[model samples]
Target: MTRKTLLILLVSMHMIFGPHSFAQQRTQKPPLHAKHWMAITGKPLAATAGAMIFQKGGNAVDAACAMIAATCTMWDTLGWGGETQALIYNPHTRKVVGINALGVAPTGATPEFFRSKGMKYPPEYGPLAAVTPGTPGGILVMLAEFGKLSLKDVLEPAIQMADGYPIEAETANLIEREKERLKQWPYSRQVMLPHLGEKREAPEPGEIFRQPDLAATLRKLVEAEQEALKQGKSRKEAIYAAYDRFYKGDIAREIVRSVQEQGGLFTLEDLARWRVYIEEPVKTDYKGIEVYKLTTWVQGPVMLQTLNILENFDLRAMGYNSARYIHTLYQAMNLAFADRDFYYGDPYFPPAEPVRGLLSKEYARERAKLINMERNDPNIKPGDPYPFQGERNPYLKLLEKWGEQQKGAAKSDSQESARSNEEFEKDFYAGTTSVIAADEEGWVVSVTPSGGWIPAVIAGRTGIGLSQRMQSFVLDEAENPFNVVAPGKRPRATLTPSLALRDGEPYLAFAVQGGDSQDQNLLQFFLNIVEFGMTVQEATEAANFNSFQMRSSFGNHESRPGRILLNEAIPSWVRAELRKMGYEMTFAARTSGPINAILFDRKHGTMWGGSSNHGEDYGIAW
Candidate 1:
């Protein structure tokens, strides 16, 4: 059908049948005719769920929604109940698509108000501070426009896991590591607590911690989705039910009551008025390959800028794991992060008069000039995209400072050397997972699921914890938005999903999960395929290093620090070179990002999916 015809038909059909009424929608089986598609994630269970749907003939979009639900259940790190954000590449329409499932700030909350009242930040991981959760909105929006599977079909795996399943070592470890916080909240205790608190701990590593409440939640969505489709509810209404159950109506009331009892500020209005922003995905050229990124609302766009700079140089010539590659990579990350700090912010609250120019071709090319190809500078400053002012209002805060030689006498901690301050700030970017799916029919999805940081921070009747995203914005009290406060309002997040295409054809479904490492890992994954031209497995296993200090919610909470936590994985030869260049770096214990990606080889007419070997998941098929 022509584009106009299709649009008209969709509108007329919805009107004729009523928005929720769907004779064809209800009785129609999800079209399961794709040649190939597979789900990839850290957990085999999530991968299996998507692969199962693909094996049974589901297309990429159908598989995308299903895999999301499955990952929520099986992956221990995913904030299944948290916000979601996604970027999609569409082959048929020759355009990039996006879904901003990130939640919005409450209407009444404001930064000045918070300052007037008391603290510089919100309550730690409190519900009063949450943005209306958006993952449910994300799922429903994707389904209304692209999904073919019934709600029940897509959610089956999650329901099973919530209702009954054997708990694994990983899940138990997560709970144990964050035990005190969970003990503080009633909901976490009730849902995650063992045997009505009598057991005093979550089920043992291999036992089960069933979630009957979550199961009931999923069941209600399935039934409501079906009925809405029949009664002709608007696509928006049909989608909103998922949101309503969580943020409005009975669920909202319960959530508000629970948090209110705890002295939280969240209310029904915040829940009822929530809306996910739908915007265009950002794009650029790296090594002649077209790279698409999400807006600065996420770190995805900034990552593309990093790749844009790195692509101008040939790192292969420097030798992998050589100090040259490590230094250059670290520099690239620092420059990109400087841009992120100065230029990237909620577009709703622009830093300097709305920087539509931040993502401009001129901007990236100009910033790329800041790199000193030969030597590293211990002293780093912000890059000013604006020429007239050339001002560096955005300073790189020292999150971790490396000791300079008292008299230019640089020192490296040898085998028996005592630990330094660098060693103390070191923490691995762990506890998160990802999912990806794509089919021959041209739909692709990448979701890096996370709720660990927030969900693990608090334990109570609200049943989850607050993500520390608020810390990033707290530094500049002046630029802080009205909703970012001493009391409530969700913080801008680091969890983002990415999609890429070649010649306007769906080419890759990808994700990376770590606090700030999310963007850093994605940049490398893209280069491994687009620049280095490596296969999925080769790209995943390739030894590499990430700059821990470049971008993250790690280490010092109040003051921003400048330190790079280099993975021990970097070869000694590379370390030697970086020292010669005057850059400060430290070794991290396995500080790697979990990457999951799927590729559609149009020339071969086949699709391949797999999790990074840096992780343990695999792509399975019939």
Candidate 2:
């Protein structure tokens, strides 16, 4: 055709399709491909830290440890005092192992203590919400057991960052926004408000924010390790020495003193007694792909249960993001989460969780039958999994009361009963950052480290922000007998990292941020790849919906039954159908993730890395 004719046709096409037509043709970011290794996390610099370790000839575990340390130091939705939960695929053993570094309630943190304070649930912030720090011990243990690099080698990037680094806009602005809360803690105010009394008391974007105290703290751990090595201790022993320094030495003393001084429940013994557990992860087979998640103490197993239930449905036939697909997934997630809120808790605690039964395939089929198919079930209660295990549910009466109370609450029409959308979204998303790393040696690590986010109370001169994870515990046993507040007991947490294997080989290592939404997003991410034929990058950027039917793990532990968050791209007809089905629909421009994932192409012997475009999440491959 002539140039004039082609121009006229292109102009006509542009007018017909609009500008979005071209924009929708490609992803905002490119996918990462690597033959040897790949590193992805919530922050770019943190991912660079992992790359630094990988370039130094360290394994995936070592690189992951570095990324975790760097992210913690940078306060990328977590801090030094935050908890760490990870799933690692050990190539040698060909097994997926769990790293449970979640902190426990400190001394005097019983439900009675909280109830006596006239609080319905634990405080959402401040020292009272603090738990014993666990990330330090978690890092050391993972390094000692599986990593090849020394503690000093793994921590160098974090130490340098702790000493001084250009604070990003997100964190700097967060400090500014939370200045009032930070001001409540003397140490936090002193550190976070570098320009105190100014309009913007927090550090400016791109300012070189230094944390000498945190740098010193990291140096102390390295010093302990070096001294142990000098004393002829093995590398593992030296690492343990550093762990002891943090949990049992001067660091512990400082942490306890700071917390107690601020009216927290932490004690010297609380720090000393906290330990990280390395255990076998729970797994389920969905269409021949084995998906794994951490056990009861976290909401990880909710995804597994959801999968077990979804296994009975042909989701691919429903079409992606169809009203039918969304409703099915939402109902399945609610059923699983209902069980999670009631039954999942610290397995080491006295009242054992009915986890064996909760994970049973037959039990899942039973739960799946509860879905109404055509509409939302706002009153979905925990299933009786105990009978599946040949045991009677001891908390049957409590479960009945819980269901009644939930049903009554759901019937509320009072204006005060409805939470503001902002408040609900805040608690729903909460805070956390995920780390994903994989190497040619067969090591794959997925971590969702959280707590001690912005507005966290800094623990004295240690520069450690205390964890606010105490908010996850229920003050009333009727709410969750297995997750009641008790001294030294782990609260049911939302942090969950995931892994998948095909025919006994590593297939996917992935995790995401957002409190209760973590599993919801992750479940869809998995399905996007496994069932919808999306690439790793496509899945990470896919538009997935969320259900807020289950009780919140943060704030007042409120549940907004039938509330659904949908991506804006969902058709109006789909929204209308969901609304007719009783869903209180909400929309957002992007809804899938900030999910970071690494898909192992075993056949090609390469890794395909994906990081969502929703946030500053990034990845590097080499």
In order of listing, the candidates' clash counts read: 28, 0
Question: Candidate 2 on 1-622: residue-level lDDT in tens?
Answer: 9998897665544322322334444667888999999999989999999999999999999999999999998899899998998999998988889999999998888878988988878999999998889899899999999999999999999999999999999999999999998999899998899999988899999999999899999999999999999999999999999999999999999998988898898888898988999999998899899999999999999999999999889887787787888899999999999999889899878798887899999999998888898989888998899999999999999988988876654454233447787788898899899999999999999999998998898888899988999999987778888999899999999999999999999999999999999999999999888886677888888888998889889987778889999987666667788989999988899998889999988788899999998899999999
Question: What TM-score, computed on C-alpha atoms, does each candidate reach?
Answer: 0.81, 0.95
Q: What is the alpha-carbon lDDT for the whole of candidate 2? A: 0.90
**TM-score winner:** 2
Give the residue spans of candidate 1 off by over 4 A.
Answer: 1-35, 55-57, 107-109, 112-120, 195-200, 230-240, 349-355, 386-431, 452-472, 478-490, 554-569, 588-592
Question: What C-alpha root-mean-square deviation, in Å, does candidate 1 show against the real structure?
Answer: 13.4
lDDT of 1 by residue, 371-472 (tens): 786776544444545542444434223211211211111232222335445433332353356667776666777766555342443323333333334443
CA displacement after TM-score superposition, residue 21 of candidate 2 (Å): 16
